[model samples]
Target: MPLLEISGLTQRFGGLQALTDFSCRLEEGELVGLIGPNGAGKTTVFNIVSGFYKPSAGQVVFAGRETNGLKPHRITALGMARTFQNIRLWHDMTVLDNVRLARSAWLGYGLWSAVLRTPGYFRAEKAIEKRARDVLEMMALTHYADEFPKNLPYGLQRRVELARALAGNPRLLLLDEPAAGLNSADADDLIRLIRWLHDEFKLTIWMIEHQMKVVMSLCQRLTVIDFGRVIASGLPQEVRNSPEVIKAYLGDDTL
Candidate 1:
């Protein structure tokens, strides 16, 4: 079975019809890209899959279970995690704390154990801290472990968000416009890091991106959406040559 399957996913915001009959699937260990011009409902698809918004119609099946109505936290616990287009790090928290909090869903100790300062609580806390540190080190952000996210550069802040998502130990990772605010050099670095992470963690990744260069360089397959409907999907080269895709982005004159 595919690691993630989104079938006939549709969303309507008071007749806006943000997405219609959208469908896609990701196999285990595949890196797929969703690309489109702005307002094509790419982020809408991410929101639906990650449980931030329930689709007006359709099914989101992750790991063979229907997830349309599940809460975001429940979905995260089910082994899915996502990074937002905008860095959503906790501004007040230390970088290490930000990543540590993502592991809260996996904490084994109960509230009573925390209040009573049970041995289990201490053990769980120690484990969470160690895991957070490990993730930060993997992302090469250990130097900023004690700094606030707002104090870091934009690119580093983006890495912090990625680390937090990884802290969840997710089987499927959804990245929304990860290259949005990166410079050319930083974008190249991010592409390499993403590829490394996919191989190292054996994760299935689905990313939404507007930067064609980033998508072309990283994604094995491309799915293009326009006005909430898929206009083309195939290998990167095939999708790039698709007439509909050309017209959508470059207009009929180019076609």
Candidate 2:
């Protein structure tokens, strides 16, 4: 079975329908791209899948179970995690603490155990710290682990967000506009890091990226949506050449 199955997803805000009959499937370990013009409801799909919004109609079958009414934290505990278009790290927290907090969500230690300073609580705390440190090292952010996120560069901050998401050990990762503020060099580096993470962690990734160069170089398949409906989906080259896709978003200049 596909890792994620989204069928006939529709969402409406009063009279404005943000998404209508949107559907797609992602297999295990596939790196797929979702692209569209502004207001095409690409992020809406992410919101629905990540439990930020409940769809008006349709089903989100993840790992063979329906996730329609589950909360975001519940979904994260179910092996799905996501990053936002903008960095959402806590400004006052250290980088290590930010990631360690994510892992703590699944630590399963009760409040009494934490407050009483039980051995299990201490062990869990130690494990969370080690996991956070390992993830930071993997992202090459060990040097900045003790620094505040506000002190880091934009690209490095983005990596921190990814590290926090990975701290939960998710099987599926949803990235929204990860390259939005990056330059060519930084975007290229992100692409390589994403590929490495995908292979190293055995993750299934679905991302919404406006940078054509990043999408073209990284995604094995492409899905294009416009006006909240799918217009094209296939191999990167095939989707790139579709006349409907060109007219809808890519335009004549895009490769």
Candidate 3:
């Protein structure tokens, strides 16, 4: 079965329909791109899939289970995780601490364990720390593990955000414009890191990106949306060559 299945997904806010009849399927270990113009509802689809927004109509199935009504935390527990378009790191917290926070969500602990300092809590805490460190090392941010988010460069901040997301141990990762504000070198490094993580973690990645270079180089399959509806879906080359996609993103540089 496909790792993710989105069918007839629609989101309505008051009278505005953000998405309509959005449908797609993602297989295991595949890296797919969701591309569109600024207001094309690509982020809306991510929001729905990640449980930030509920769909007004349609089914979101992941790994054979229905995910339409699941809460965000519950969805994370089900092996799905996402990173936001904007940097959402705790600016005051150290890079390691930020990632450790994500790991804590799945720890086997309760109020009693915390109040009494039980062995279970300590054990879980240690495990979380180890996992967080591992992710930081993988992202080449081990040197800045104790540095605050605001102390790092913009590109490093993005890496820290990615580390936090990976700390959740997700089977499927949804990345929203991960390379948004980076120089060419930083963008290339981000692409390499994503490719490395995809293989190392055995992950299925779905991303919404406006940077055509990132989408073209990183994703094998592509889905294009316009006016909250799908305009095209195919391989990167096919989508790039599609007339409809060309029309939707016209006047911009991606040609």
lDDT string, candidate 2, 1-255, tens digits: 999999999999899999999999999999999999999999999999999999999999998889999988888888999999988998799999999989755886889999999999999888889999999998889999999999998998999999999999999999999999999899999999999988888899999999999999999998999999999999999999899998886466655
Q: Which regions of candidate 1 deviate over 4 angstroms?
A: none
Q: Rate the local accuracy (lDDT) of all candidates.
A: 0.94, 0.93, 0.91
TM-score, cand. 1 vs. native: 0.98
CA lDDT for candidate 2: 0.93
Candidate 3 residue-wise lDDT, 162-238, digit = tens: 88999998999999999999889989988998998898878999998877788899999999999899999999999
Off by over 4 Å in 2: 250-255
lDDT of 1 by residue, 214-252 (tens): 999999999999999999999999999999998889877
TM-score of each: 0.98, 0.96, 0.96
Clashing pairs in 3: none
Which pairs clash (backbone N, Cα, C closer than 3 Å) in model 2? none
Candidates ranked, most accurate by lDDT first: 1, 2, 3
Listed per model in order, the count of residue pairs whose N, CA or C atoms clash below 3 Å is: 0, 0, 0
Local lDDT at 30 for model 1: 98
Output the lDDT of residue 96, model 2: 96
